[model samples]
Target: MCGRNATAVYRFGRPGRVELTSAALTMAMRGFAGGGETQITAVNKDYRYTVFDRTSRTGFGEGGRHDTAMSSGLLIQRAGRTVAAKACSRDATVSAKAQAIIKPGPYVPH
Candidate 1:
């Protein structure tokens, strides 16, 4: 769970790592819950860290259910292209603090 002081860490390559504080994570969560595909970015020196999420519902569903698919991950970009990317696990669980920030809508598949 990411709180006001918490941070998310991502490692790429041999020793490259990026740490995103709660502020960026919160923005990413909000972007994810808002709708459509979103990308929230944070920069440190010359590296850009981008957090992205995409949500869509299957045509077979009528209301909020398991028919919706949600995907979230992080990307490391240098120059203007991606250098590394990682996806959240399918069984990932969120803490209450993170959940409050996400505020899943009725159309969200929980």
Candidate 2:
């Protein structure tokens, strides 16, 4: 996993066998939040995410023009509902890191 300040590769295994380090996760969170204040709870999580590819071209030649693209990562939820994100969406790698954290499992606030 690549964090804001560090990178690591985790190999999952049997329960209690593989553990996610706090430092690595923190780095990733920092990258996602971009040094912005983040709030984590059983309800939701918030952060600042800037899109790398914010501009996109639409249509064709003459009329073709560049426009801002609007996109966001998948919605994460603990139960049967969707948890609202404060500021979500960034580059592909950052989105992947965010997804990894919200994957099915226990939530440990960093």
Candidate 3:
């Protein structure tokens, strides 16, 4: 995950992991930071995994404070139905450059 459009691999369980190309990861992160929803699909064996993030905003401009929350997770689907779902840890932190990378755009789906 170093140079020019590399892939990032995330392991959630033994023999369970998802590999996301740089472009996909960037889009997902941008969408997540922008308080929007984004998804990336990956296939392993017979399972279809959808890694997604959903963000919600509240109290915007209220007393000069805005509250934003995001929930991220992976859903495993087989035969077009969800089989398992796992939520990412709540303690995760976004990088310091998060604000610089955000760009407004239409909803992204993959």
Q: Pick the TM-score winner.
A: 3
Error of 1 at 89 (Å): 0.8
Best by lDDT: 3
- Expressed as tens digits, the lDDT of each residue in 1-110 for candidate 2 is 23342343332235688532222222212222112212222222342221121223333454654333433333234444444433344543334444445333233332
RMSD of 3: 6.5
Local accuracy by lDDT, each model: 0.50, 0.31, 0.52
Point out the worst 10-residue segment of candidate 2 by lDDT: 33-42
Instruction: Output the better candidate (2/3) by lDDT.
Output: 3
Off by over 4 Å in 3: 1-5, 10-12, 15-34, 91-110
TM-score of 3: 0.51
| Per-model TM-score on C-alpha atoms | 0.48, 0.25, 0.51
* Weakest lDDT window of 10 consecutive positions for candidate 3: 1-10
Q: Give a tens-digit lDDT track for model 3, residues 19-59.
A: 43333233344444437665555455565666666776754
> Is candidate 1 or 2 superior in TM-score?
1
Instruction: Give the clash total for candidate 2.
Output: 2
Residue by residue across 10-101, what tens digits does model 1's lDDT show?
33334355343334332334433334554445566566666566766554544644466777777777776678887988624334454444
Q: How close is candidate 2 to the true structure, as a TM-score?
A: 0.25
